[model samples]
Target: MWKALRITTLLFVLLGVALSAWRNERNATDWIGPLVVAVYPINADGSELAERYLQALAVERFEPVSAFIAAQGMRWQLPRTVPVDFRLAPRVNALPPPLPRDGNVLSVINWSLRLRWWAWRHDTYAGHWKQVRLFLLYHDPARSPQLAHSTGLQKGLLGVVNLFASPDMNAQNNVVLAHELLHTVGATDKYDPSSGQPLHPDGYAEPAREPRYPQRYAEIMAGRVPVGPDEAEQAASLQQTVIGAKTAREIGWLR
Candidate 1:
């Protein structure tokens, strides 16, 4: 009898969590109001430099992301002027669960559940109703020049972004964060996984531009500027990127 009761209670809790997540996901791309994104900075490297960077962190540091979203929303002629409101959450003391290494489906699902539960425990932002939670794991650029891949789950409305903890990297970091933030709201990558090349037409910022060998701006979801047929370069900042029409529709900025 005791074992059966415990199992029933667990199932009930899981059901409630699932329903809440579903509701959040449904409203994420509605474009009715500015969605609040609480950015939780974590010291991934555990270095003195990373720690110091966190101490001086401010909401202004992430303004580029919010600004970009607003600008895109205006371009799409969406109802809301400011599409996203970014808030800086208190620094998280603990690291999140490590992602699966083998890329197995079952393993990935397990990690997703673990990460959502972990996020619930650490969220401390209170200014607004946080529609999305983004955990920015900061590392010392000198120690780990190349960071691990970031992840964003739409169902859970959460993202885990790897970033370099340096003032110089802020622009690049905002571009990365913006990409992952859109992922939490049902945006898909427009780049070819193997080649890392932005697909033509859909992935392009100006597919119809005359002499399109060199693109002036990158489609935000595509994530890189297509300079030539065989070459692409990462956008230095969100300023050099635009939300393509496909991405706009994916995020419900357009019908």
Candidate 2:
């Protein structure tokens, strides 16, 4: 009888451990598929800003910026693995990238419309994604009139400031990077261009400046109320609702 009892207890312990592992793995898988940031070829010689911009893209892949945005009850369509690549070509079409075998491919193109269209044609075939979101930034600042008019041209397509000519690399990179990615899964920019007021109802004024609970940084998107570091901790607090199964489905993170 004692031996049988011992065997049963051991079996229970093993089962508990297996259950725990399954739960943890399932939770981790709830996020959107990995984010793949593909950089266009740098045409201008010695474009330091472009170089740094690509680095910033790499940084954003793993770094947690805003828990609320990350957890906004949208199952992030993050990939099982997020990959960012910087290609050295003169044009977007010339870069040889493997088309996404499955799922969405968020393409952030900073190149000519002709080249951008070419990429669009090749990237989107049948059975790619539930949707395909392609965004283009005006590659040239001198042509703002044409570019500005082109902002909302295509459906499922968005155009913003093409920062290739912006003197301030950091600001341009931060805004463009954050904005384009947000649009991929139906997120709207909180900041309005006219009054600079946050469009969303959230109280965050300046995410870069504020780091409050539920929010961090003054930038509103990921600010700490006290304005300090602890981004991972802040993001973790949001996970109860951020990376769950229901949230993932809402944001198309899971099919």
The TM-score values for the models, in the order shown, are 0.93, 0.36
- lDDT (Cα, 0-100) at 222 in candidate 2: 26
Over 1-255, each residue of candidate 1 has an lDDT whose tens digit, in order, gives 999999999999989988887888888877777898899999998998899999999999988898999898889898787888888998898989999999999999999989988998988777658899999999999999999999989978999999999999999998999999999998999999999999998889999998998999999889999999979999999999999999998888888
Per-prediction count of colliding residue pairs? Answer: 0, 34
Model number with the top TM-score: 1
Candidate 2 per-residue C-alpha lDDT over 1-255 given as tens digits, one digit per residue, 9 for 90 to 100: 999999999999989967764553343334444433332332232345444444344323324323334433333445433322211212333332322333343432323344435556544223332222333332333433232211221223322324354433334333444444444433333444454443333324332333333433333232112222222221122222122233234335557
Cα RMSD (angstroms) for every candidate in the order listed:
1.9, 17.0
Q: Where in model 2 is the C-alpha error above 4 Å? A: 1-32, 41-90, 93-119, 122-161, 165-168, 203-255
**C-alpha-based local distance difference test score of model 1:** 0.91
Number of the top-ranking candidate, with lDDT as the measure? 1
Query: Candidate 1: where is the Cα deviation over 4 Å?
Result: 1-14
Residue 83 miss distance in model 2 (angstroms): 8.8
Clashing pairs in 1: none
